[model samples]
Target: MVRQETDVTLRRCTECRGYAYGGGPACAVCRDLVDGLVEGAWAVFLRQWDTVAGGDQERALAEMVAAEPDRHDWRIVDAAFDRLVCPDCGGRLARGPVGCPACDLAHGFRYAAIETDRPGVPPGNEHAIRVNVSVVRRPQVTSESEVLVRRLLLPLLLAGFLPTTEAAQRMSALMKKSPPGRRAQLVEQAVEGLAEEFSRTRRAARAAASSPTSPDTPAATRHRSARGRPR
Candidate 1:
């Protein structure tokens, strides 16, 4: 499940002037680093899972399941972001790009101003890279249970409901809970529920985006009536 924080307040980072979660530094750089490590680890873990058998395979899987939450812990990245600084200008990078010329050149001048609820690159290049790497590194699925989990989780994963590692972790948990006799039916019901939720979220987002702005009040109007008689 996606994690949630309560009663959070955003504050501008001292260096970048962009809002950070709980008023901490912008976490883009830290998020990038952590995501890279997690994706690389997943690639290795999944590949190993494909190669091993019996007790060895079970042990590896157990290790992965146990480590999954820590692998995606925000505290780790948040702490790292607090300490990290731009190498070129020695400025904090927690909200986004600092005024370092090199950093601006690398990330774009407007990087800090790009408002987003999620961390990392605004264009999703980081996510794309991770997905590509996972595809290239992980072996094709051979187990029926693995295949079922992937089918159940792929849509949500692609839709950004969760990260790849979390999806894999959830897949393992779900497979453990499902019995072969009713797995197909249970999976179908879960998929339908997820699809409905995704659709509702999409509709709400679209409605918000398309909602009309408030009408201009006369006091705020800048244009004046034409002078004299209409020409």
Candidate 2:
């Protein structure tokens, strides 16, 4: 079953700004920030998905999974054949589960008798739902420069380049590490260079797509032949 990843109220690591489920453990980004792993309480936990499994798209696919639901008709049909005896002669009960085939006698209907069991909780804690933890792996962030690159990811995403109020916190960290002028220069340099490369790549792709291929039709051959003839 495709279900939404456990994405409710996630907390952020103060040092790296990476997300985490609780306050106890240092998240992947901030290995030095905290000490102990936080024990979680019993709650409804959605299965965690890896990148290939489509991180958050599981929720959307869940709707597609249950698109067709099962339905059963409530009406019932019954017939008796074991007790089907000849109404006129009162002799043959040859019919098994249907009507008397030879006599054409109406034997009436037979229904399954249903008795409801008294509802009570089953004995055993084994039947109870088990509590499980959704382990969120840490982001494999290495350096501050990498973090800066990550910070610029949102603006660069649509440009087909390097793949946000939360962005303010990250920006604050970057600004603290470098002088204002240097920080601005660094960001401008990175973003502008990436933009130029992305534009060049996009233009090349468009050119390739739009370029006409060699025509294989007889008409193309004739045209080629015509062109080959000197004026």
Candidate 3:
């Protein structure tokens, strides 16, 4: 009888408790799932594992983490930190690739990495910043309603040029407090004054062209325009 070689699929990391895909020595899923949610992510995974696999799995996970605290990479803060809380389900996400399959099908994580110029620097000099991010399953935008609404409303909201209801009322009150003329009447008066000045300028220019060239033409009648216009 000839001995034949048997093909076998290797399991995922037994220590990290990842599903086996027969690709690597460690949990390939865990290694690949670098969304940046440091230790809190591992805690969530362990907690879930504990709930599903019972006390034994929990003990194993605890021991593994205790041996290597950096596995989770979650900074143990003295105070409560701001976490992404689901508005619909009120489920808290632990910074990395995670999802509630019941509420959502997306499995994602969030985390930060130290991309240092000098990796061998001392702890004091190692510059690292916490960057928060989200990775979600792409959702379909079925309508152009959002774009339409934004385009219509954004201009009105910005640049205090247009009067809102309250603003209109305020302006009305201010005009009422002013002495004598109505706002429209005042605007009309200003317009009439501008028309008169423009007519006078044209008449003067015509007269100057018809008349002989003089040494002084009284500097072309230096009449000003209006407020918000150059003098």
Candidate 4:
């Protein structure tokens, strides 16, 4: 059989755990789903957070974060997303095509080379069966996304707006929440708060380091400066 020779790759959705197969961006359905989530993200986040945090939302959230400082991931709750279906075979695509029946059928070679006997062949004939190699192409979006996010985080890390790289990561992941106007305001407030705290810590450290040293530091400095009573 002649191969189609079309190059395509599959992408996996992070939020919905769905799969989309194509050459460029993900399928239209997935884009629409994530776009909807991004449009009214702040409200959605608050609603989801409130439900997840139960009573006394702020306190609950604080306690939860304190329990696991590096584990407060955003979750899209109370919604179901449809998995992407392959355009060619009308079958659901798998995330990166591991053990996917449709993917195996569409792109997997599914066979190994083997020797077979032919009718009327010589007594010791050892001919091998012809085999075709098929490679399933998977999207490289994850690594690309990581590099892009790292580039975006560099400025925040240098500017002291974010105290650590991990915090920058979390903030970047949650960037869709605040709208443009609100995003600017929130960023300003956050930077101001962090800057103030950083400045305060530095001042405290300097004061502690420069504090009096048993009333001997000044005397030693003077003795060193004197010329032994002009002798």
Candidate 5:
């Protein structure tokens, strides 16, 4: 007796309506966002591990993992809207058109359609902890070192080591001055400097956290006191 073969249907992503590969339920973009979120969260966790009090570490880790999805979504939205402008009024698309009603309506429609799919972690501490633990245990390499250096750049900038304009200027100058062969070395050294600065900022933060708080401490400072060791 001959057996009939059955055709299997691939799942389509709800957001993009594309075939979902790798046995995943979502399209590549959505699936990759989940990976990025996990990796980003792990990077943040490693950097800020020393900032959390020993007793509160578990809770802090969970909260940090939970926050990654929203952060990822907002980053996507911000990038999508960046420098987008109204054609008629030439106003920023994010702010909407000032005088052009047609542009304003179009901007509203486009803004409403902007993708902000927040890929999330699996429920429960076990999954997050297990995945991150595996991440930490993975073997390191030169490329990973460079990636870590690159990852620290934004955090360093946000922590205010140097103005963004100056940093960009210096980077441009370095690229112009260095030969192609030496450029990678020089760039790596520069990023390492930024990483060191970030480390110093984290150290200061840890010191502040350990010190007794004053009633007169500014609310802003107190707020930042809660936020790292850079690797």
Candidate 6:
């Protein structure tokens, strides 16, 4: 069995307006922000993903990693096998210990061993009507492609060209809804969506870096260090 990284929360750093977890201070990128600027969102924490081993997605990532571990610069990326989302906003969702009340909102049914009371049956018959119900989460019911586009593609586009498990979900969703002849169209759309964001982020930094007059490069222009701070 492969060991896994200690789980961490996913919080949005106020300074950088980027996601950060693995607590301490606001990540390096946003350290300049005042303390407590880092805000945590359960939805983000739950839906956000990271690379892991021995879970369902491990086999798939392992195959790719073994085939070309060197092809990618990073040792790991998000490899999520499961997907969940917020029912209200369709924003990336996080999971938490669910109480009876909360469970009703998140799941269409409740996981419970229920005893049935029959109107016509005598009281003694109630014992025979016990049942177990497996409640599933309320589905978004949107096309998989739409989920992929919003959860994965949108973030990459806005924040730059980073890829994560959310992107994979988006792509998988697209594969399901795409028409037979137009499948490539969905793929290209995903790429284009990512590219658009990458372009903007790169351009902002480029312009700042190239300018000779600026006394200090803007925070957004600098590259993030391993700890998420600007170098």
The Cα RMSD in angstroms, rounded to one decimal, for candidate 5 relative to the true structure is: 21.6
Ranking by lDDT: 1, 5, 6, 4, 3, 2
Over 1-231, each residue of candidate 3 has an lDDT whose tens digit, in order, gives 111121212223355542222111133443333222234444556565554334555545544533343333323210011223344456442322234442242111222322222232223221121211111111112122222222222112111112245643654464455454454344334333433454465467658765534334445753446689964
Q: Please provide, for model 5 over 1-231, each residue's C-alpha lDDT reduced to its tens digit, 9 standing for 90 to 100.
A: 111121212334466543221112123453453345334544444455554423355445444433342333222222223334445556543334344664445434332321221222112222222222222222131243333223323223223233355865787687678786787568757866755665676577767766556445665555333235342
TM-score, prediction 1: 0.31
Query: Which stretches of candidate 3 lie above 4 Å from their native place?
Result: 1-32, 36-88, 94-119, 122-129, 132-231
What's the lDDT for candidate 1? 0.40
In every candidate, how many clashes are there?
4, 0, 19, 0, 0, 10
Error of 4 at 56 (Å): 69
Error of 4 at 205 (Å): 1.2
Runs of candidate 5 with Cα error greater than 4 angstroms are 1-35, 38-163, 213-231
Candidate 5 lowest-lDDT run of ten: 1-10
lDDT of 6 at 113: 17
TM-score-better candidate, 1 vs 2: 1
**lDDT (Cα, tens digit) per residue for candidate 6, span 111-193:** 12122333422342222211100101111343434332333232232232335568657777778878968875667566666
Off by over 4 Å in 2: 1-147, 163-181, 214-226, 229-231
lDDT score, candidate 3, position 161: 16
RMSDs, each prediction?
20.7, 28.6, 28.0, 27.4, 21.6, 22.9
- lDDT per residue for candidate 1 within 148-183, as digits (tens), equals 444344334334444345644765676689989988
* Model 3 score (lDDT): 0.31
User: What is the per-residue lDDT of model 4 for residues 1-231, given as tens digits with 9 covering 90 to 100?
Assistant: 111221222234454333321111334554443334222332454576664423456345433433342232211111110123444445533223345565444322222212233332232121111110011113332343433333232222222223455755555654556675676445445544554565576567557656554343475543332465563
* Each prediction's TM-score versus the true structure: 0.31, 0.26, 0.17, 0.24, 0.31, 0.26
